[model samples]
Target: MLASDVCPGEETIAAYVARKLARDERDAFDSHLDTCSACQELVAAVARLAPSQSADPVTSIGAASTITQAAAEALRLPGAQLGRYSVLASLGAGGMGVVYAAYDPELDRKIAVKVLRHARAGDQLRDEARAIAKLAHPNVVAVHDVGRADGDVFIAMEHVDGVTVRDWLRTPHRVPEILHVFEQAGAGLAAAHRAGLVHRDVKPSNIMIGNDGRVRVLDFGLALADLEPGTIVGTPAYMAPEQQRGEAVDPRADQYAFCVALWEAVAGRRPEAGGRRPEPGGRRPDPGEPGTLEGVPDRVRRGLRRGLSARPADRFATMDELLSELFPPVPRSRRWM
Candidate 1:
């Protein structure tokens, strides 16, 4: 290869293609691969030429030798077609799959296409599409289509041009600004609850704040119509007690997570500092006890406390109710007729 074709991390390609890179190193490479076109082409070439008989776990690419499944999926080059969408570039990857920025010729618009990691996840992907498809709210990411291509299941969704709420919170923001973003996200959650679906995962990273000043709730991958008991899912820092215990969960669980995220954003600390899960049958924090949230307004603190209650029953009946508490409505003025 020419010197111009060489990338900084070229040495790791053999280990990466052979699936021998340490977990952290591999993850670092994955992030690097997203933006490094030269590295991507190098990795794809190495995978194609590497021996197939290696004992390492093999992630096939069109009947080729071993490669990390995530790498294989993310290597879909520009101009590659997944169904009718022309892949432009990889957006990112998560536990479930890699998201790509693509163009739909039929609609003549840019879209996000998430290609799942496992073929068996097709059913779950369909489930997520169905859940989000039910809501037409501005605060929710819209799902456009779901289909399979080359044994991979994918969901095409609205391409959001903005930072995640977690990223948005990196800079210091006013209390009102934080609440404004979260209220819109909460509205999306409320809509999902009304549609008989629960977004099992609600964290700052899952919420997006578009450049247009719109807040949207995305990634309903863990959403479910029924809470299957004994199945624990969600980010640990934001999971409610019920979710931690692998017990059946409802919309209130999402309320708990929302409060945790909002509390962290406003107070600069989570109500539960360490992402600790309260033990089953553990004593709920005394509602009257003064906690870490010192400077927060009385009403906002009270609202967050109730939402973070260990027992779901102690939480606001619905996401709408919690939102009202967080951002109460102003009373109308009475004028002389």
Candidate 2:
């Protein structure tokens, strides 16, 4: 009745979708799938994900600079193969997994593929990828497909050409430009919220601003549809007080993270070290106390402070309310109405 109980060497989701199993084996696996919703849903989605559209061209490729060729090769790079895509170059490495720019010859496009570090994490990745693929917002990174190749789980995604918000913050940016990009990032979170999902991780590193001047929120690796209490997950520096306490989290948690990161972008420092690491649950920094706040407009400063409030109820009730405050309506001319 459980996927774990299923004997090893059964047809993988990809193999099942590809009809690579022998008749008897396929029938047995089909019988097993009836009780294994995880594999059943995975195989269904993978089948539905078959190349149905033309590829969107990636104007640019390599954006991240880390993990050298030799290092990547050790991770099975350069000529490494995963499902329908082949590795082209290492994009970056992170806690979730190493990302590689890959070529999907079937789709005839360059896609960024995340290869999970643990062979056992295939189910988790499948759940995460399914949730992300359902989110189709412009400011959200697009998940094209997911598959199991050999002993690895890989997610093929739209390759973004740009720097993370953290790296982008290293440069000088006018307040308007900063808020504009962040608004896009917030929109991505807002969209996820509307879809009943919460981005448990919302630090600057998860946000990307492309060369095309578009801001995208990437990596739903830590996202959850119904985040319950006592689920501590996210960067400590940007976590909401409730999130740090492992209490229930909603979209407001992401709003808190957004403000914290935005304040850092403005002040060039984190508000407060909530904790030394994940689940530290330390005090949050006062947004108004940062010396740099003097240079920031009162309107923006006030909004950030409310968003960084210790209590979720005290913050903007929703992302729409937050955006309304961040970018207030221009006094419409009486004539325009």
Candidate 3:
């Protein structure tokens, strides 16, 4: 049976899991599982609900013993209502929450719905929504709505049809192409900085390239209006020194992460991971040092080195400044000449 032909139920799933289903039925269910996300989720939930080996297996197939409760709700299958939007399918999930591809009946359009993990995370989700909603740049994902549903906070935003920069980098790209994508993403980050908000988490995975060929910076879950000293946040590999030290951060910190991502894209490895450690006093090794950025151009290496500086002050004062360094403007000829 194909995915469309399968209508999974608690009993059917339980029978399949308990090995009570006939060979043909099991084969058909297996075929459906290949493409049915809802059924796949049910199978996972069944696994979780399974009793220990010492205990008798679930032979009876009524409701699958707790399958219809929390597990079912967590699945958020198609037609499930989340605030004003109807959940179509789950796009992905992370530490923050699960992102669902949903449809807005009133607006008659599809949107990405991020259901935060913590029910009490409404304040933070609202903050993120407000911060992103204020940014009108083409490189920033647009926020459409934010609300609470069934004790969960959800943010509705633009549904981008594309892959993360991390995935995009899986395919080899020219230096110019890499710079072009990051330039657009940097513009979005710069726009956030201009609005007095700091994206505490900026990494390659947080940046995406849409099917329309536009690059966008997204997932401002850690963003905030005011920096609180001693509050550490962000991915460790891409974090600036200050961010890792629990010190207050600014736009320059984001610049450091952007450079790290760019460096990885160009050099095929992170600076530290490439076996280059910081010099004494915690400063990064000079870009001009031998064996660093071997094939990269001098100008690009210089900009990346500065952006990855240990001290925020040593890095570019603003994202726009760093972008300028990475993609310098063509000089105009003098009219008199």
What would the per-residue lDDT of candidate 3 be over residues 1-337, giving only the tens digit for each residue? 3243756667677676555666457646754653465566656455444533224334432454466563565667889999889999887643345678999999999999877554334466565667667778899888887787887667789999899898888899988898889889999999989987788778887899999999999876565322345745456667788876788778988998898888888878777665566555456666677877777777898898789888888888999898888888879987984
Where model 1 places Cα greater than 4 Å from the true spot, the runs are: 1-70, 73-75, 118-128, 224-229, 274-291, 333-337
Clashing pairs in 2: 230-246, 274-282
Query: Could you tell me every candidate's TM-score relative to the true structure?
Result: 0.73, 0.68, 0.72
* Model 1, backbone clash pairs (residues 3+ apart or across chains), number: 0
lDDT values for all models: 0.72, 0.67, 0.73
The better-scoring model by TM-score among 1 and 3 is: 1
- Provide the clashing-pair count of each candidate structure: 0, 2, 0
TM-score of model 1 relative to the true fold?
0.73
Model 2: residues with Cα > 4 Å off, grouped in runs: 1-74, 117-128, 224-232, 273-282, 289-292, 331-337
* Order of the predicted models by lDDT, top scorer first: 3, 1, 2
Choose the strongest candidate by lDDT.
Answer: 3
RMSD of 3: 10.6
lDDT of model 3 at position 14:
69
